[model samples]
Target: MKVLISGASVAGPVLAHWLHRYGFEPTIVERTPELRHGLGGHAVDLFSSAAEVTRWMGCWDAIDAARTRIDSMTMERFGRRPVEVDLSRMYAGISSSHVEILRGELTRILYDASRDTAEYIFGDSIASLSDDGSGVDVTFDSGTQRRFDLVIGADGLHSNVRRLAFGPEEPLRRWLGGYLAVFSMPDIFDVGNHTLAHLSVDKLVGIYGVHQTGQTRSGFLFRTPHELRYDYRDKDEQKALLVKEFSNYGWRVPQLLEHLESAEDFYFDSIAQITLDTWSKGRIGLVGDAGYCPGPAVGGGTSLAVMTAYVLARELAAARSDLASGLKSYERIIRPLVDQSRRIGPKLMGTIIPGSPLALRLMPFAAATLAKLPTAMQRFIWSQNAVGKTLSSVNLVQPQVSQSVA
Candidate 1:
């Protein structure tokens, strides 16, 4: 069978890899002109199940070696002493196998693994998708037309495939009452393999080192009473908005803002989740953040994306010629995980970005205390939370390919 996948970042490449392995031809269409493979981009985590998928792909060792070796974090409040938390220890408590790596690096690794097996088309996108029950006829923005047995959207939030296959994103999107901005800058504080964060009520400013580039990334996450209106594509407008919001805010923010205008890779977006009743319509289906994004930053989106793509591929292969049944089975299998994942973002937002002064004080204290706990006790405590429960519940075993495929 021939399949076409959208967005080459995380899920697309992963789905491509597995589809090819399962006796299917996969073609990837990425909007970007070239592969984004470098030290740039925000840090993302891969928990046990996601790690296991990579291990099965034979990419685990490479990903582990490329991990961001940030082991500790220092939380600061205005006029208060810094509270230190062992991030490595905390991560260990959360999942037995976990790695934090730059999103670009992970994409590069996944892309490299799948590039040899799949056909990749960069600098183009699906302009329209016509699923005729038998196949999906896709028209690209570059004016190329092709037909595939199935089409999948592995794109991230604000996916082009989702917009084309489903409807507009506004009705399906649930704003989580927060926003996030990230940009790269010189390592002025000389922070090496550590994260420094300044927390205030309803707001957080963080700077973490990128050992591979010898630079640092500044991230600002803040809560708003109502959604802000702005063009998602305008970087200048977003930068100005960020400055206005944090104008009166103190604590090294001024220094950070100085480099904002010149930062070419600045990213700004709302922390929102996609609520779709189903991920498929006939031969067209959606995977990863395209279909169901719990929320960005706060939610374990990376792991969710990785695991769902893997499941989608497995289900499709199992269904063989009946691809429609495969899509339905994929949705049914992942619905529980997706539902459980949606609950994580809001609870984490309340905890990470405090709503009150009391919470601001208590958040750091709680993190420090958790980090100080013994590994066993920490695991016990974490196992009771939403994240732990979600991670532990994911069970994926490789099923033998039926002789029918060959």
Candidate 2:
């Protein structure tokens, strides 16, 4: 089968990997000019099943070696006598299995592993997709056109494929009333080879020294009741907001924002969730953040992508000639897990970044509950967050070989 997968991030390449394994020829299209090796923002982690997929993809050992040099995190109040909470007890609320790495780094790894076998179209995307019962004709932004047996929108929350195929993104988007910004800076803090400090003033400002990379990762997240008047795509306005919001704030914030102007890359976005009533329309389907991202707060974004991709590919190969049934069944099998994960995402974000003073007063209590070092720790540690959260999933099932032809 010939397939077209959009976005080079976690989901698209992952889908390509599994599709290749399943004997389907997959073509991956990405908007960026290259495999996005750098990060848009902060570090991310994979837990449980997602980590398993990393191992299957043959990149786990390297990921482990270059994992975020963060030994632990310190959450501070930033007053003259800062109140500090050790994060050793607080890292759980997400998942037990953890593979902390930059999102871009992970993407590049997946891309490299699959690029030789998979057809990759960089610096482009689909302008439109027209399906006529059999296959879809895809028109690219670069004026190139092609046809494919199937197409998947692994794009993201603002997936153009989703918009073009499923009839716009309005019905599927949920604004979670917050925004996050992540940027890089020089190693000026002498963080000493670990994720050093986390400062919270009703919000979160944190930094980590990415060991061996010779760079530091810094980010801040906060709540916004209504959308602010800022260019959602303009880097200057995004950086300016970070500076405006944190300009007068305390505890290394000024220093953190200082790198904004000179930073080569910056990641900024509204904290939102993508909830599709159904992830498929005819021969088209959706995966990862394009289908059911639990928002960045859930920290399962990457895992969801890999697992969704693996499951989708497996379902396809298993059904043989039954493409529509295969797609629907894949959705049914994955929905329960996806819904459960989504239910947990916002609650997790809220727990990390409280909305009001009443909520802020309860942080210590919540922190105590999260520090239990078991399931309690796992659930509570990942509670309320500011911006995007980094989480991923993996497919645990083996695909059945299809005997019939498409």
Candidate 3:
């Protein structure tokens, strides 16, 4: 069987790895000119089953070596004393089985692991896909054409494949009334190794030193009742918009803006989730953020991407010669976790972005108090947070495989 996968970031490469393992010939078409690397992305976490899947792929050790290793995080208000929270203690309430790494680093590791196993075509994308009851005829942006038995849309939030296969994305997109921008900057704030964050009503700015990378990761997330005007591909316009939104704010805003002007890897997007009634129609299917993205920065979307790829591959292996059944079973096994992730994002808004002056004043105190509490009490307190519980509940069953991919 021949499979064509789109967007070679996290999910696309992972799906390629498993498709090859299941005796299927897989080819990946990535829009980016090359494998994306360096400080292009922010810190992301893999929880429970996601981490286990990496171990099963034999890349956990490489992933762990590239972790952010952030030991503490300090919160500061405009006129108040900064309160430091121990990050290690905070993560304990969550499962011990977690891997926190830079998104780019993880992507590079996955690419290296699977580069030789699959045929990868960079600087291209699927321009059109036609399914005629037997296979998908794919047309590439570079003007090449091919036919495959199946096509998977592992592309991200604004997936081109989703637009072509499903329809327009406006109705399926649910905006969460916020925007997030991340970029790489020098440690101009002089933060040695700890993460420093400043919060105001309806806005938050943070900077954290990435351990061995010699660079810092900074982000700006703010609430906006309505979507702003800008093109997703225009970097200068996006930077100008960010400056316009955060120029009057206090505490390192000026310096952060100064770096933003020249940062090569600036990423800006609305905080939105994608919900669909079904992930597949005919020979086309969607995975990860393409099908059910649970907002960015708030939910564990990375973990969902990793685990869903594994689950989808397993179901396909189980339902050999029955692609529709495999897609249905894949959706069945993954929906509960996707639903829980979406629900948890809204619940965290109050904690993530303070709504009032009083909320900002109390935020550091609450975090400090919780960080200093007894282990058992901390666990009980975190039990109230829906994100942690939902992350722990993801359990993917491994299928029995007698033969390995040659």
Q: Taking the tens digit of each residue's C-alpha lDDT, what string does model 2 give over 1-406?
A: 8889998888888888878877888999989887778554478777767777767778778767656756455555534233344454455445566777887778777887788889998899899899987998999999999999899999888888888877766677777767778878888987755665443534777677766567788877787667676666799888888787778887778777767898887888877788888999999999989888777744467767777787898888877766778899899888876776676657766666765666656675556555655766366444443211333322375445443345
Give the lDDT of residue 319 in candidate 2.
Answer: 77
| TM-score winner, 1 or 3 | 1
Sliding window of 10 residues with minimal summed lDDT for model 2: 385-394
TM-score of 2: 0.89
Q: Report the C-alpha lDDT of model 1 over 1-406, residue by residue, as the tens digit.
A: 9999999999999999989888999999999899987877889999989999999999999999999999999999998899999998899888889999998899999999999999999999889988888998889999999999999998889988889878899999999999999999999999989999999999999999999889999999999999999999899999999999998898999999999999988999999999999999999999999999989998899999999999999999889999999999999999989988998999999998999999998999899999888889999998888888778666988556442353
lDDT of 3 by residue, 208-300 (tens): 987776788898989987788788889899888999999899788898888887888899988889989899888899999999888889878
Whole-structure CA lDDT of model 3: 0.85
Top of the candidates by lDDT: 1
Ranking by lDDT: 1, 3, 2
State TM-scores per candidate.
Answer: 0.98, 0.89, 0.96
RMSD of 3: 1.8
Each model's lDDT: 0.92, 0.74, 0.85
lDDT (C-alpha) at residue 340 in model 3: 85
Highest TM-score: give the candidate number: 1
